[model samples]
Target: MEILQIDDTLSLKRTVDGGTEEQRKAVKAIISEVRAAGDQALRAFTEKFDAVKLDDFRVTEEEILEAYHAVSSAVVEIITEAAANIRTYHEKQLRPSWMTTAENGTMLGQKVTPLDSVGVYVPGGTAAYPSSVLMNVIPAITAGVERIVMVSPPGQDGKLPPGVLVAADIAGVKEIYKVGGAQAIAALAYGTETIKPVDKITGPGNIFVALAKREVFGDVAIDMIAGPSEIGILADDTARANEIAADLLSQAEHDPRACAVLVTTSRTLAENVLDEVYKQLPHLPRKDIATEAIENFGAIYVADDLEEAVGAINQLAPEHLEIVTENPVGLLGKIKHAGAIFLGRYSSEPVGDYFAGPNHVLPTNGTARFSSPLSVEDFQKKSSIILYSEQAMNENGAKIAEFARLEGLEAHARAVEARLK
Candidate 1:
């Protein structure tokens, strides 16, 4: 890990990958084929990419039961508890349809409606993240989406991971599919013979999956184009070096492009954390990935004071921000940007990743400056409602016509005039 002085030139912004031209072309072809051939295209692509030939793509209830048997009872209980916490958190975000009326006999408000259907893509390749299934699916369920579909790649044995299946079941997902990559995204965006199209797609995947989401965005809604994991820590001399090092590596192990940074007021703490990170790196199972990430993107900065440290971290706008200062809660109001804020030593970043009630799906690559984490609002749409009594229409009809005619919209003016007469 490199240590440096905080300056204006320092930035944590990473370039968002848009995929190579060849990859884009391939994604376009896959989407077109899925739209044209439907289920046949899905089967062919599953065979070619996943090396699993399946006449049916959907997971059966029997398979789900088998998945339960494969997983330990303790793990099942944990997932069930996590699902309950997530549901309880998201249910607070649900808002009711509201309207207001005045003496003029006019009613205006917004009606909130959950999406008809949603597709959640859980990545399958090097590892299976059951946490993602809970993070992405629970909010949609909370919003009362009628249909929720899950798609993940099957292993060489032609079965999805047991943990992933268990999490989906606990999260109230009834539909699961054994397909992945660009093709699964296509199937979600455009209906296949067996899988109906969804109104929105959410979750993270490889570069190809990101590209497919980008291509299909306008046709159907999508979550943001997420980048690799990131963690930014604001600490002081009171913070422990070893604990901070471990929290940084937790995100570093996720991807080679993952970033971990520390901005602190203590030079002694900075040097100790740098040494501690190197000492701990060799022992991790994902040492190769974490080492690459740490060598390339990890850094420790010594700021003049706590105010300077907070300012630097706000500029980074990290996906996860941990405040390990003596008074972490006092600094909360000063934090202008962060996907999730963990205060004090006990509230580590991983708490939010798994057991914590907050959604782990967050904006990365400095996008937290403008966007937000995945929430129930993402799975719901708002419709504006307008109502006018006859008296109100008579009072404002001429003014409405004049305003329309001012914009040279004669047809619009005539429509209101006809209603008035």
Candidate 2:
């Protein structure tokens, strides 16, 4: 890891991969074909990309029962507990429809309604992301969405991962599909023979999945165009060097493009962490991936003061921010931007990733500056409510017409006037 002085020139701005022209063209073709041929296109794409042929894309209840037998009982219990924690957290975010009336007999408020249907895409193949399943599905279920569907690619054996299946079942997702990539996204958005279209699509995947989400965005709601993982640590000499190095590598192992950064007031701590990171790098199973990330995107910055370090972290707006200072909570008010904040050394980033109640589906690539993590609000929408009694309408009808006529909307003015008693 490189150590440098904090300066205005230093930036964590990374260009997001928008995919090559060829890949974008291919995604558009896949979406078009899925819209045109429906289930036939889905089967053909699954065979070509996943190297598996399936007459039925849906996962049967028997298969789900088999998944329970495939995994250990302890794993099932852990997933069930995690699901409970996630549900408890998101249930607090739910809001009921509300309205208010005044002396004028006018009612105005907002009605909150959960989406009719949602599709959650989990990446599959060699690795299974059970956490992704919980993080994306639980919030939607908590929001009371009627139909929740899950899709993932099948392996060469034509079966979804046991852990992924278990997680989905625990998360209260009744529909599971054995398909993935751009085609799955298309099926979710346009509807196939077996899979119905959803109002929104959420979860992360490879570049093709991201591109497909981008292509089908306007037609259906999408969570966000997520990039690789990131972790930013704000620490001082009081923080342990080895622990900091280990936390940084936790995110580094996620992807070659993942970024890990440390900004500290003590120069000695920066140097020590730099050494510790190198020492620990060789022992990781994903050493090749972590090494590439640490070599390219990892950094250690020596700040003149705690204020300067916090300012630098705000500018970066990392997906995950960990403060390991002597008084981490005292510095909370200074943080203006971050997808999630972990105070003190004990609150490791992975705690929020898996066991913690917060959603791990966060805005990446500096989007934390404007966006937020996936929440129940993402699965529900608000509709403005307006009601006017006859007396109220009579009192304001002329003014409303005048205002509308000011904009040369004669029809709007007439509509309001016609309702006036």
Candidate 3:
């Protein structure tokens, strides 16, 4: 990992938020074509991108059942267990329709309504992320979304991954398609003859998919324009350098562009962890990818004090922040922004990525400063319901009329006056 000698305030103004400009332009073109041509364009694009032409894109009930059977019984149990945990965590987030009444008979409330339909995009690139399938689908199901449509690229055999299909089943996803890349995103945004358009789409994909979601955002709601995964480790003299090195390696393995950074007040600890990172990288399965990440984006920053470390972390706004220092709680209040904060050495990024009930789909590339991880709330809508009694209208109508007239909106003023009169 590169050591950034920090002597002044860091200015990271030009960091790429999501993906390259090429990805954005390519995805926008696909979305535009899909919007214009509809299903016919969908089929053509599917054939060209996915390398498989389909008579129908939507999965049948039989397909879901078959998918459940296709996977090992052991794998099925794992997916099922993960689903239960995810459900338990999100159940608390369910928002109920509420009403409030005034003494003068003015009542106002919001109706928490589940969306009619939603879409999920699963990546099928270098690896299949079944966890993402669960993370995206369960929340929509918990929100009582009526229909959940999913799309992922098929393998060389032109069939969806068994793990993805099984996870979808566990999460109560009803419709899935054998299409992926930007084209799949387009098909979901603008309905194809076979792939129906959905109200919203969730889940993570490659840069192309992220860009496609950004392009079709107004047409269909998306979880977030997610970027590469990242982690920030705040360690002190109390922490073990080996353990800290292991934690940084966990995030480095995600992608070459992924960031695995270490910020420490002790120069000795920082140097030890750097030495340990080299020792541990070779044994890892994705060492090649991790090595690239560590070589480029990965950093070991030596801070003058703990406060300086926190200040740098807040500025980075990493997807996962690990406070591995002494008295992690004491420093907790110092962290102003992050996608998810892992306190103490035991609380690693992997714990949250798997097993833990928290949603792993997080904001990336410093977007956490403004965005949040995916949750049940992302799938639901809120509608305000208001009822004013005649007496209440009489009490406030003159003031309302005057306020509207002050804005030079005579029609608005007359509308209230007519009701009061």
275, model 1: CA deviation in Å? 0.5
lDDT for model 3 comes to 0.84
User: Which stretches in model 3 have alpha-carbon errors above 4 Å?
Assistant: 7-14, 17-25, 36-39, 60-70
> Could you tally the backbone clashes for each prediction?
0, 0, 0
lDDT of 3 by residue, 1-421 (tens): 7666555654232266566777677778888888788777777787887777776777777777787788899998888888888889999998799999988888999999899999899898688888989998888889999998889987767678778888887788777888888888888888866777889988888878878888888978888877667888888899999999999999889888788888889999988999999999999999999998888878888999988888898988888999988799998888988999999878878888866788999988788899998999999999999998999889889999999999999999889999885
> Clashing residue pairs in candidate 1, if any?
none
Q: Counting only residues 3 or more apart in sequence or on different chains, how many pairs clash (N, Cα, C under 3 Å) in candidate 2?
A: 0
> How well does candidate 3 match the true structure in TM-score terms?
0.93
Please give the range of 10 consecutive residues that has the lowest summed lDDT in model 2.
6-15
Q: What lDDT does candidate 2 reach at residue 353? A: 93
Model 1 vs truth, CA RMSD: 1.2
Candidate with the greatest lDDT versus the true structure = 1
Tens-place lDDT per residue, model 1, 144-261, is 9999999999999999999999999999999999999999999999999899999999999999999999999999999989999999999999999999999999999999989999
Q: What lDDT would each prediction earn against the true structure? A: 0.95, 0.94, 0.84
TM-scores vs. true structure, each candidate: 0.98, 0.98, 0.93
lDDT of 3 at 398: 93
